[model samples]
Target: MPGSSLALLISPRHKVIHHDGREVPDPTKNKAVMKELGKWWALLKDKRFFLLVPVMVGFNWNGTYLGIYLTRYFSVRARALGALSSGVAATAANIVWGYVYDIKAISRPTLAKSTWVIFSVIMLTLFSW
Candidate 1:
């Protein structure tokens, strides 16, 4: 019964539709084999997927450095408390934003770009000293 409100907002059950608009069963096997890993290389060779690598890395790098630099504004115990508060804030943000996005309070693509801009501003404010 936990998360039932979220469940009611969105159904986990859905038909899988292919790119060609055919409804097909999802693959039962979740694990990928080494042989199948070549598909990623093929994608990169064909000039796909690789473009996302930088975006992924940029977000991670920004978050890591953001934490590091933010802690500089605090003493030892203050840093620890700041980290704790930051973690709690992150959890609250995730739950609230997940619910908001699930209810279409904001469009997914717009939310994504907005978060990027917000984080960039936060980073600039924190680290531009």
Candidate 2:
């Protein structure tokens, strides 16, 4: 039921035709409808949304890699402590990021571009070690 409801909500618009080919519904009239639907689809289809997927994967991988590497290099207790510390560090970082976003002094696109650079640097650092 939920899946069907989701599908109904997300289904794309279809053009209908009149019988006898006399006249059909104007497509320009449907532009508003399509635009509304596109807003929902853009959650996944938009370039910005898709770009974040790989960044999230890389961030998670970095955290996991750091945890496992620390464990192997040190002891299990040390690894656990390191992981806990990393979690706290991530939370603090997120808090700072949220504050910047809430302040709204800069546009979102500017923030996103800066964040892309920061994410790239983080990934490079993670992979270099």
Candidate 3:
């Protein structure tokens, strides 16, 4: 199949690095298995991943409920349209929020306070409806 065969033509020209500043070993080359495992273990021990557990769980739970609601209340075509619109809206929101959050001129404390205010307003508006 063309889909399966197309992947064979692609190759990474550069070395990959882990988030914790470790270089990822190329699978094509022989390396020590225990050293690689140690790197992975170090990454697993990072506190940041654990901190995101609740957020990850909530996202998945919300998505599951959204899927159920869509299927229950919408026709096939309407469901597809709703999914596309939701995806586009989410992307646009992320882009706008990224721009707001990345404003380098704003002091971190000011930005954090503004973000909290905006978030609170949005959440209150949403929950009030």
| Predicted model with the maximum TM-score | 2
> How well does candidate 1 match the true structure in TM-score terms?
0.44
In model 3, the runs with Cα more than 4 Å from the true position are 1-37, 106-129
Q: List the residue pairs that clash in candidate 3.
A: none
CA RMSD per model (angstroms): 7.0, 12.4, 6.1
Please, what are the lDDT tens digits per residue for candidate 2 over residues 1-129? 667777766434344444665555554665787788888897777777777776888978977876677867998788778778878998999999889887768999889898888888878777876
lDDT of 1 by residue, 35-75 (tens): 56887677768854554555566667777986787777767
Model 2 poorest ten-residue lDDT run: 9-18
TM per candidate? 0.44, 0.58, 0.54
lDDT score for residue 17 of model 3: 53
Give the least accurate 10-residue stretch of model 3, judged by summed lDDT: 120-129
Candidate 3 global TM-score: 0.54
Q: Candidate 2 — which residues are off by over 4 angstroms?
A: 1-42
Model 3 sits at a Cα RMSD from the real structure of 6.1
lDDT of 3 at 33: 95
Judged by whole-model lDDT over C-alpha atoms, candidate 2 comes out at 0.77
Ordered from best to worst TM-score, the candidate numbers read: 2, 3, 1
Off by over 4 Å in 1: 1-30, 35-58, 70-73, 104-129
